[model samples]
Target: MQGVEFAKDLIQKEIRGLELLFQSLDEDEKFNEALQVMSNVKGKVIVTAVGKSGHVGKKIAASLASTGTPSFFIHSTEGVHGDLGMVEQEDVVIMISNSGETLEVLNLLPTLKKIGVTTISITRDKESTLAQASDIALSYTYEEEADHLNLAPTTSSTICLVIGDALACALSNKKDFTKEDFHLYHPGGSLGRNLST
Candidate 1:
């Protein structure tokens, strides 16, 4: 395979997915609801997922925390094995699942409901079980995956990361987060150096 040719196709697919995601967000009022939950939460934002979504979830949690939202990530499997203790009734939990029916993610809902936390689910299926179960559902549909095989999580995870960034930015705006607040949480990196100066 010509590497450049393959890369161009993949890049085009990713761009297309982002376009669709943007359109979906414009039409979805639930995005605003999720933002309200994150903005008003007196507790940390807890993000959970498994597999590729888990990796994306970690970044989402980190972005939220650094932007002054106070957040963290927990593997759904571990949440079941006692990590859920870290979550609180006041916390807002966000779950990521490409298919929206991931068993590991779904398995946590019953307990989360009992714990009385506000739950949000990000998935491609708005009507999925996980979406239906959560208090707020953020869903988007991408036409296809980036690779020729069309079997990887590339586009899906990219879109999820973008969604997380949007949420973090929204909350940051709502809270009037400034460079000073950002420096407080991110004081050791080049980004911190730039913000501090």
Candidate 2:
């Protein structure tokens, strides 16, 4: 029962954070700016991150790609080696860092700036280095993580994922993405099977 109680408490905390995020989304002008940039992107959306955020970024990239946004995820470590070449001047890059100071992701900024691609960032603080350096910053406020220790990335990462989802959905709708378009990119899944008919 203690473990179950812990789970419930954690879940509730995260839910509360999400509710706050949803409310703030209506007031965040940067989100709208980010959406406009994404909608106008002529090249692919490149997502980069490190640690746990990197995992969430990969899911975000996949979601964007399948929903009519051309996108791909490149690990920050791999990006510096040669993968950064995949990014082009027309691309829009989205970087995620909880503290907005992750060196690996920050290091990519100089080259990205030189490439002259638009950059957006997801972080907890609008003033964070990652946010300040970005063309637009989509940020959130959370009291703490949803764990007993309040150190894990549960809440913050959830917000990042939600932000990514909001962007993907809004952009898809703005662009008038159709069921046929979704089916075109996702042809092997149960979703695709259903859309086929």
Candidate 3:
């Protein structure tokens, strides 16, 4: 296949996968509960994940932090080492894992609970250990990836990113976050200039 056709196919496949994700969100009520939990967080939203999910988690944390919610990404492996101290009792943890069984993520759960921190999970498997252990779980199930093997995490990661955005937006709306508030956090980029004007 030509490069253009390949790109088009990938985009189309991702669109379909996102459509499925939207449908899943519509059917699940846990998303709203998760948002409510996050909206009430008295401290930062601690985002954690492993591998590709970790990269997505970082973006999610940045999105949340910029959009009126205080948040930061803590690599699961790093958390176990010493970064876990950054998490406080008032914070809410959002752990991301497509399978919901990432060892690093799961390992931090008990410690979080012991510290009196609330945990939220974004995962494809509601029954997975991470989901079951979380105070709230936002399901982000996807049918398949755009790649032929369906193992590159294209679709799943996209859905995860969207879910993170959804949560950030919801929290921002709840807080009545205005463009002025956004500008305070982002005062150097084009976005800052746009919001300032």
Q: Per-model C-alpha lDDT, please?
A: 0.94, 0.93, 0.90
The true-versus-predicted C-alpha distance at residue 117 of model 3, in Å, is 1.0
Residue range 19-97, candidate 1, lDDT tens digits: 9998877788999999998899999999999999999999999999999999999999999999999999999999999
Please give the RMSD to the true structure for each candidate, in Å.
0.9, 1.0, 1.1
Off by over 4 Å in 3: none
Model 3 C-alpha lDDT per residue in residues 26-144, reported as the tens digit of each score: 78899888888888888889999999999999999999999999899999999999999999999999999999989999999878989999898999999999889988888766667
> Which model, 2 or 3, shows the larger lDDT?
2
Q: Which residue pairs collide, candidate 1?
A: none
Error of 2 at 142 (Å): 0.3
lDDT of 2 at 146: 93
Clashing pairs in 2: none
* Candidate 1 weakest ten by summed lDDT: 188-197
What order do candidates take by lDDT, descending? Answer: 1, 2, 3
Off by over 4 Å in 1: none
Per-residue lDDT of 79-190 in model 2, one digit per residue for the tens?
Answer: 9999999999999999999999999999999999999999999998889999999999988889889988899999999989999998999999999999999999998879
Q: Give candidate 3's total backbone clashes.
A: 0
lDDT of 3 at 157: 91
* Least well predicted 10-residue stretch by lDDT in candidate 3: 139-148
The candidate scoring highest on TM-score is 1
- Candidate number achieving the greatest lDDT relative to the actual structure: 1
